[model samples]
Target: MSFCNPIPIRLKEARKKAKLSQKALGVRIGVDESSASPRMNQYEKGKHTPDIGTLKALADELSVPLSYFFCEDDISAELAVNLNKLSLSDKQKVLEITARLIDESKKG
Candidate 1:
């Protein structure tokens, strides 16, 4: 069996996490419903890569930042999700906390 590419793996995981079937995600992103299933299947199989516009649409429809797709690790992806859920004030607080943690790590 062919090893899955990271993009395809991430796409499938995010789609499932959002509780969308491939056809559902395709239609939500404005693909014609008739072709949605095959189109999304192609994407998830790494047979096709969506252009940036389509990628942005997918990200928006899935309620995730586009950066989530490019993250190299699950931790980074999870961090992106958590950070995206924060309000501006809360984001700043998170940054401050992260900075403090980094400083503490350096000291210890």
Candidate 2:
């Protein structure tokens, strides 16, 4: 699937995880309150894609990294969410461990 294919699925997932209704998320991301639900619904339905700037605002409001919306699978998307909770040093440690695991798997 195209990279953009994951976006609507991940957007819906993140919005749900944040416990937000479509309207609420849209409003929080600066859409007019009156039009928020319809706008967000269109996005979730993949009928319209938000621009990068709007996506960034949605990411900020939902407390997820913008990259989360582009992850190709659920595991990677979930990893991004968990990774966002780490400190800079801790994140570096995770990257090191992940790389080591990949090397070990490759060698075995």
RMSD of each: 2.9, 1.6
**What is the per-residue lDDT of model 1 for residues 1-108, given as tens digits with 9 covering 90 to 100?**
755456777788899999999999999999999999999999999899989899899989998888888887899988998899999999999999999999999999
Candidate 2 segments whose C-alpha is farther than 4 A from its true place: 1-4
The TM-score measured for candidate 1 stands at 0.86
Q: List the residue pairs that clash in candidate 2.
A: none
Top of the candidates by TM-score? 2
Residue 70, candidate 1: alpha-carbon lDDT: 83
lDDT of 2 by residue, 2-108 (tens): 44578899899989988999999998888999999999999999999899999999889989899998999889988998999999999999999999999999999
TM for every model, in the order presented, reads 0.86, 0.92
lDDT of 2 at 10: 87
lDDT at position 90, candidate 2: 100
- Tell me which residue pairs clash in candidate 1: none
